[model samples]
Target: MRLSELSVGDHGVISDITGLPPEQRKRLVALGLLPNTPVQLIRRAPLGDPIQIRLRGGDLAIQKRIANCVEVCLK
Candidate 1:
């Protein structure tokens, strides 16, 4: 499943992020969102343009388009 599909409070492990460009992938990795990393859905903006997630003990907000490219295994 994609990160964008996860609901608030849901947790998952990233499986792949090949759908994103190199720069985007690097940015995500810098935020500790690499493949195999655990991620928790925190919340989303009212319009859903950006979604908040917890990783590496902090919150990271990503756009919906980027979230769609992150494949994950739900927990």
Candidate 2:
């Protein structure tokens, strides 16, 4: 499922990042978001716009639209 569809506390491994913009895809990759990498839904904003995720020893915040581009296999 799309990363955006995962609820807080869910864990998964990234599967596809081809749906993101070229620049964004590169940036995410640099931060260890490559395919098969493990990820966890940390939290969400009060309005649920941006979602927080933990991966590769750190956390990153992703917007709703961008999150839709991240495909993951839930664990």
Candidate 3:
């Protein structure tokens, strides 16, 4: 499933990242979002645009559009 489709409190491992602009993909990878990494959905904005997630012991808020490019396997 796509990371953007994960509900709050869901946990998963990243499987792939596709369709992102090179810069954004690189930034995410640098932030520990690489494939095989564990991830959890922490929260979402009131309007559900930017979603908060935890990975590699850190928290990050990412846009849903960017999240769509992230494929994950439920954990």
Candidate 4:
């Protein structure tokens, strides 16, 4: 499944980030969202364009477009 498809409060592990642009992929990796790393969907904006995720001890607000680029597996 894609990260954007995960429900709020759900946990999932990153399976692939290669689907994203090189710069975006690098940015996410630096944010600790690497393959095999677990992440939780914390919340989403009212319109849902941006979603909050928890991973590696930090929370990041990622755009839905970017979120969709992240492949994930449910934990």
Per-residue lDDT of model 2, residues 3-65, tens digit only = 999998999999998667799889888878889999999999999989999998899998988
Reference-based lDDT, residue 24, model 2: 89
Candidate 1 C-alpha lDDT tens digits along 1-75: 999999999999999886788998998888788888899999999998799999888988999999999999997
lDDT by residue for model 4 (2-27), tens: 99999999999999975677887888
Which pairs, if any, clash in model 1? none
TM-score of 2: 0.92
Which has the greatest lDDT? 3
- Give the candidate order by descending TM-score: 3, 4, 1, 2
Q: Give TM per candidate.
A: 0.93, 0.92, 0.97, 0.94
Candidate 3 backbone clash number: 0
Deviation in angstroms for 18 in model 4? 3.2
- lDDT tens digits by residue: candidate 3, 4-59: 99999999999999998899999999989999999999999999999999998989
RMSD (Cα, Å) of candidate 1? 0.9
For residue 12, what is the lDDT in candidate 3?
Answer: 100
Once model 3 is optimally superposed onto the true structure by TM-score, how far is the C-alpha of residue 6 displaced, in angstroms? 0.6
